[model samples]
Target: MRRLLLFLLFMVTTGAIAVFSVQNATAVSLRFLAWQSIQLPLGVLLVLVAVLALWIPYIASAGR
Candidate 1:
């Protein structure tokens, strides 16, 4: 069933996030050029960066 498969995928993604966040419970700072970010949870920052990596290209191509 498609719904069952989707449900399982959701569960697996959440489980992965839980494990990753638990394992990477450290604070870190990020900087770029003249910009800087305050310390944030390592896992949280990584997830945001990963999402942006995928999102920026998609947005850039959306006009075509």
Candidate 2:
């Protein structure tokens, strides 16, 4: 049951990403402070940020 739910969640996220990327094909750059990243699809950048948001908390909890 837990595994099935996780699998379903994964599938949904994958589908969402696919649709978002297809809908947002425009290239854009990201700049932070003095650094910048090359042009990338806005959908991909958003997904990467989402993954990082989830990952940071998980890593932070590992030391406790």
TM-score of each: 0.63, 0.69
RMSD per candidate (Å) reads: 2.9, 2.2
Off by over 4 Å in 2: 31-35
Per-residue lDDT of model 1, residues 1-64, tens digit only:
9999999998998689779988999999899999999999988887888789879989999968
Q: Which runs in model 1 stand beyond 4 Å of their true positions?
A: 1-18
Clashing pairs in 2: none
Cα RMSD, model 1: 2.9
Candidate number with greatest TM-score: 2
